[model samples]
Target: MLNLVLFGPPGAGKGTQSEKLINKYNLVHLSTGDLLRSQIAAGTELGLQAKSLMDKGILVPDEVVIGMIDTKLNENPSAAGFIFDGFPRTVRQAEALDTLLGQHNTGITVMVALVVDQEELTKRLLLRGQTSGRADDQNEELIRRRVQEYNEKTTPVASYYEQQGKYVAIDGIGEIDQIFGLICQKVEAAQSLES
Candidate 1:
């Protein structure tokens, strides 16, 4: 399996890159944000519980997210692998994910983070807010908070993978194709090491 964690702060082009990576890798794209949104739109119990928290830019409880992930994993028994986006926001979540994957005898292949400065992220997100229809994206304060939250709460997940020698950082300030190519190179290199 070629499981990957496409890591990046908000507006770092993770959704865009994940789309391209999934196209090439035939990987199951499991974006927790998308999943939560779908559930919210469907009015599922978890979604109902998460909507208020999300609107406030707070992460949902780990157990709720983990339950959703378990369901997704079970749903894709024959997947080539998965591209995990918007997940493992805390080191604890990363550890939980490790345990979950270990239960299935699989593990993360790599966590390839897109490193972009905060200014670029703010610009990209404000631009995105215009068309994204995402309430959280429209507020500059919220975007800053989200980025701050990621830095404080989520960056450690990279270190978690780094300790395992599976973290790669790619420059995200460039043409989309160039960034994609760089990511592909990193993924290929990681997979080779895994093999």
Candidate 2:
């Protein structure tokens, strides 16, 4: 399996690129944010709890996110691969994911991080807020908090993958196609190495 971890802060174009990657690679999209939003939309107890934390720009507890991911992995036993977005936000979560994937006889192929400046992320998110109707994107303070949280808690995930020689960083400030092409090059290279 060609499992990939699409890493970035909010508004880093992971969603857009993930769609392209999924189409090209035939990978299952395991987006935790979407999963949580679905739960929230259904008004489940977990959704209510996640909504409360998400509104405050706080990450939902690791176990909740991990459980959701475990369920998805079980649901797709014969997937070509999976593109993981908005997940493994902390090193502990990364470790948990490694263990989870190991139990299934597969692991992350690579982690492609979209490197964008904080100022740009804020601008993109604010503009997205105008159309996305997502409350989290509408407030500047909340957006900053979310990015800061990612920096503090999630940046180390790069090191975790880097240690495994499976981390690649691409500039996220160019045309969408250009950035995606760069990602494809890196992904193809990783696939070759795996083969």
Candidate 3:
């Protein structure tokens, strides 16, 4: 299976590119944000818990996120692959993910990180906030906190994948199609190795 982790901070275009990659690779999209949103919309207890932390621009607890991912993995037993978007935010989460995939006889093929500067990310997120109506996105202070959180908490996960020689970085400041094309090249290269 061509499992992949789409790595990036908020407003790095992971959602936009995930759609394209899913269509091209026939990979199931396992987006933690979408998963949490569904739970929140349903008013589930888990949703309420996630909402409290999310409202403060904080990450939902790892166990909660992992449990959700486990459910998704079980729901799709014969998936061609999966594109994990906005997940494995911590090295511990990455290790847990590796264990989960191992139980299924597969592993992350690559981690493609969209490299965008903090200032640019802040600008992109503010523009996105205007339309997204997501409270977390609308506030400048929250957006900066989100970016800083990613830098402090999530960037280390890159080194985890890098140690496995499965990390790829692509410039995220460009035409959408152009950036995606770069990602596709890296993904295809990894897929070839898998075969």
lDDT of 1 by residue, 85-186 (tens): 988889999999999999878999999999999999999999899998888889999999999999999778888999999999999889999999999999
| C-alpha-based local distance difference test score of model 2 | 0.96
Predicted structure with the largest TM-score when compared to the true one? 2
Give RMSD to native, each candidate.
0.8, 0.6, 0.8
- Local distance difference test, candidate 1: 0.93
Worst 10 residues of 1 by lDDT: 150-159
lDDT of each: 0.93, 0.96, 0.93
- Per-residue lDDT over 1-195 for candidate 2, one digit per residue giving the tens place of the 0 to 100 score: 999999999999999999999999999999999999999999999999999999988899999998999999999999999999988999999999999999989999999999999999999999999998999999999999999999999888999999999999999999999999999999999999999
lDDT of 3 by residue, 1-195 (tens): 999999999999999999999999999999999999999999999999999999988899888888888899999999999999998999999999999899989999999999999889989999988998888888899999999998899878999999998999999999999999999999999889878
Model 2: runs farther than 4 Å from truth?
none
Query: Which residue pairs collide, candidate 3?
Result: none
Each candidate structure's count of clashing pairs: 0, 0, 0
- Which residue runs of candidate 1 sit more than 4 Å off their true CA positions? none
Q: Give the worst 10-residue stretch by lDDT in candidate 3.
A: 57-66
